[model samples]
Target: MDNEKVRLQLYMARCGVASRRKCEEIISQGRVSVNGSVVIQPGTKVDDDDRVTMDGRLIKPTRKNIYIALHKPSKFLCSNEDPDGRSLAIDLISPVIKQRLFNVGRLDYLTSGLIFFTNDGDFAKKMTHPSSHVEKEYVVTTKKEIPEELMENFKKGIYVGGEFFKMKSYKLNGTNSVNIVLEEGKNRELRKVFQSQNINVKKVHRIRIGNVKLTGINSGHFRHLSEREIKSLLRDSSSKNGKYNNKGNRHNIK
Candidate 1:
């Protein structure tokens, strides 16, 4: 017998409700129910036959998957709604992608760049998990020229809000801009790091996520990721404990 039951939060994440960790939070708050019974346990297993619901709405298993690479523009929140009437990233996605989809991670409201969205929760979990260590490359322009010492500080790590944050790699791109690769995705982390050095970031843009790049995709436009691109992302995320893959590809924008 091939009996396999995945964790409930993992299942919910696959449905594009939220990240697995956030799904766990939703479950603990009694927002998730299985077969009409509220389930607060994050590790509860459900097989293919089981029915799941969130917030009293039944969750339908999806066979058709949607993966979009969005060139997110500044001022768009990566959320479903905003009380201030600001636009959300979802507003830019094609209406054809009506299947529940959520941003894999986050980009600040003032940052412009490539962001991935998908209906596959397992893929989301694998990409965003700290253990996966998928590198995110960015092109940042600061108010002042980045000093060589500050570049070293980025490599050595800096203390921000009592937490130590570090960049995996940093390089001087131009007089006022720098290219940085970060393995950890903390909230407004890059901005905070630059601020700690008394430098103001004038612009921040994510150039690459995993093996996918934002090349040719204009701001506010989105397109489905190619099959090869999707497979490459999975391969890179799977190599978390091994050497970084996809190093020499010309499409690596940042």
Candidate 2:
């Protein structure tokens, strides 16, 4: 395995620590060591014989990959560390799942919905990559009636701080709510669109990601993704199909 040396960030990700990007952050913080020496460079490479640790804790690549679907509730942070001591969404699964896992993407502190956690770094990269084109569906509720021009402008696309934001599709749920789908879930994309139109958003909850749905799951709870479900997500990431069928068996946390 001498020729198998890889970058530090990629190694951490393969060990189920976190995504490569998050691993890079950890490395920059001087939390990782190679051969007993703290290595802050994310590009540092290592071979099979090298010893690697994080915060003095030995880390090795996990043999079995795990995938999970979590129904996050509002007010929970989707991060490994929070300065304000707020509730963490990952805390809900850590007690039951022994392996080290991290979130694939983030949900706003006040926005709740279906979130994914996994130990497979490659899978995380596949699902969150810009070219994935994976659809994320959300139900947005507003305090006042949604004007026709607001949805029209959103579907047609608009510029927010020089960043263009648009929705893949939308359907009005009521006078003040609508169901929307987005392929590229930019940071606060929905909120920015509504705010641009002077609309006060009351809630934004994700109901689906790719082929997975949040149905039958309660807030702050999680379930293991079936092999087929995992395969479907990876498959859909490369396909152009906008409709994701969710018929996977749900294994709820007892």
- Candidates' TM-scores? 0.88, 0.89
lDDT of 2 by residue, 115-223 (tens): 9999988889878876667889999999989887778777887788788887878999879999998887788888988888788899999999988999988999989
Off by over 4 Å in 2: 1-3, 240-254
Worst 10 residues of 1 by lDDT: 245-254
Across residues 83-134, which tens digit of lDDT does each residue of candidate 1 receive? 9999899889847677788888899999999999888877888888766678
Lowest summed lDDT across 10 adjacent residues in model 2 is found at: 245-254
lDDT of 2 at 226: 86
Candidate 2's displacement at residue 29, Å, is 2.9
Off by over 4 Å in 1: 1-4, 242-254
Residue 45 local lDDT, model 1: 92
